[model samples]
Target: MNQRTFRTAAATGCALLVAAVGPACTGTAHAASPVGLATARVADAVRFPWLVGPVVVAHRGASRAAPENTLAAVDAAERQGFKWVENDVQQTRDGKLVVVHDGTLTRTTNVKRVFPQRAPWRVRDFTAAEIARLDAGSWFGKGFARERVPTLREFLRRMDEHDLRLLLEIKNPQLYPGIEARIVKELSAAGWLDRQHVRRRLVVQSFGANSVRTVHGLVPEVRTGFLGNPPLNALPSYARYVDQINPQLSKVDARYVAAVHRLRGAHGHRLDVFAWDVPLQNHLGIASTYGFDGVIV
Candidate 1:
């Protein structure tokens, strides 16, 4: 395999990054399993010349390999030669944007132990400074001990250093009112909303249809995706607001894929579809068979 070199800084105390390259690698700075094979081999695959095959996105920065949403997880994705990554973002109590999955800090961080009284430690129930004190990575392993929940700015900086593309999910917009504005503000301040970046390397997605529509109105140039398998009749309306329709792995087939491709997005491009949380190689074969545009694994 051919190889090259690049370095990306891990958040705060983590080490510098060094990722190897191979034929499967497609970075600029750069630089799933099984039995469903018959479905994957279905005839009349939707082929887009822009991509050789379905784009594979590292979920929460390679969650199985590192504590999710931490800089460590992002680096893990880079090390595995993944160019595109998908991570969730939520706002802190002080309205600071942070890269984390859950609306609460319980699962991925040591919030419970740190603030014993802060039961049901809602992410918005604590300040970023307070949340910063918890160990975000130790739950996954000792080597990752002290990994902290990164502020959105910190996460984006790391991603830029690695020259990676991002599919940033607006985790739970309802929990954080005006979050759409806050998110766009942060991305804009980070230079990610620039035409070049927005056009080539960034996407903002939300499970909430209204939140996604709000995002489209805020910055239509920045392509956005709506997460869900809405009824086929809703396709035209959804296409008006989103560039992609990202549904769960179990919710699609060739007919669905073809339906999405037939429409033009708000951005004037073919609407795309990406399945989320897919597991096993057979599923990947099926994505190929069903002609998905991407998969969040």
Candidate 2:
């Protein structure tokens, strides 16, 4: 794996200044805002030993460059020197876990042509074998026509081979009730729970708070995060079960980041704040200005 670069303080200051002043600033001298100063302080204080700084998480394995949730996408991200990749997982009709992002397959796959009778192609309606036959990448481009929707086991094996960290989101837990336990079982069966290195690299996250709590109870060793723009009053409660709080990028600011850090949970754990769907250019600057622990770009 290759080393990743973080944002420098000078760049962060410039970005924040630009953010504070509208793009139409006409060389007007402005006083430093309280939010800007606080953001810088929080950024300096929130450093972790295992991480260099705010981590760069490739959302959906660099979805902009390749088909989302396919092994080819992950391989592309690895080739680009990204250490952290995020993907979604859901159970098929036969209870087999597959890597996919949508409730239906109309968008990213050739499901309509392959399963012409299976309209509204929900993932739960198909068995794993049925899903494996669908071309997951051709919709993106002809160059990726051979890409397949990889299983959770295949995804993890690829991540391990590349020494990459995974941010695994359990997509639509309500669709597959008891999926939390199933995911834990799958992880254990794959020897992920037995290896210390693998355990450190794995993180389970979900938009459902209950699902996050369920995973925390089932596998306390793996770090978990909740994805949503949760209420400010709910931070303390979320900290009890999750190690990180991943809110929408637009919802994040210095005040929100500080509140998350202040949440003290079991074993004196402070919830790390990560923002999602952040754009590529000036990402570090935005992360620093908002005091994020990680940015899912």
Candidate 3:
């Protein structure tokens, strides 16, 4: 949203960080994904007490301080003491996973200048090497000149180095067929599906239900969240696949939140709800008071 500044909502006993603007992050409940996953020495996940009041998950790597989705952002979030971080990921033409938020390369990178003929440079149209050559950070500020679009491995390497929890989003899954599986495969190869990471730190999410289900089907052990509010009647069915429901801040209200909490997830934990796109005018503070497990600014 805007450059992020960390402050405590002292009254609510919560830290404020936004995914877009600032944050109230997700807490760790426990330890412990499945796809082409070979048993390897997995990265460790730092644990936090479950049910803590809105945690500070740096939205796009403390976007206020660093370019969103770049290694700089990830490092900034870690430098700023954020325990968790959120980011969107998708595949390149050669099937490598890269961390980025937009479908087109125009917004965050120097794609237009680097490849003048490649109008509307859809991420899918470019090979990883082509995408890698573009400058991803100058648009945010010149201090980050030469910062490259990080592959998911690069991004996760930062997370691993810091032991930060991840709320990885499969941005626009429909644009990349089998992306769900690819993501799982990547995570597995990276040793992210091990018991410690799975039991305590990672949660994969998406607005697409099928994508969410596909992730669940691949690795039932990894916790999952669905990013839209389904009708109340459908919660049980969703519960069979996901551990949380993440709705935009506008759709969240006390009653709906209570209903979500009343259910149990596929893992037998109480269903959690994390609200995103929080409003202004102290509404962000108010949302924390609504008993939401976390608030995504």
Question: Residue 90: error of model 3 in Å?
Answer: 0.8
Error of 3 at 225 (Å): 0.4
Native-to-model Cα distance after best TM-score fit, residue 239 in candidate 1, in Å: 0.6
What shift in Å separates residue 224 of candidate 3 from its native position after superposition?
0.3
Q: Rate the local accuracy (lDDT) of all candidates.
A: 0.75, 0.76, 0.74
- Which ranges in model 3 have alpha carbons more than 4 Å from their true place? 1-52, 279-284
Model 2 pairs whose backbones collide = none
What is the per-residue lDDT of model 1 for residues 135-220, given as tens digits with 9 covering 90 to 100?
99766656577699999999999999889899999988999999999989999899899887898899899999999999999998
Superposition error at 128 for model 1 (Å): 0.6
Clashing pairs in 1: 27-31, 28-31, 32-280, 32-281, 33-280, 33-281, 33-282, 34-281, 34-282
Worst 10 residues of 2 by lDDT: 23-32
lDDT of 3 by residue, 44-68 (tens): 1111222234654666765655678
- After aligning candidate 3 to the native by TM-score, how far in Å is the CA of 221 from where it should be? 0.2
lDDT of 2 by residue, 132-201 (tens): 9999876766667799989999988888788888899999999999999999988887767776744568
Q: Between candidates 1 and 3, name the one with more favorable lDDT.
A: 1
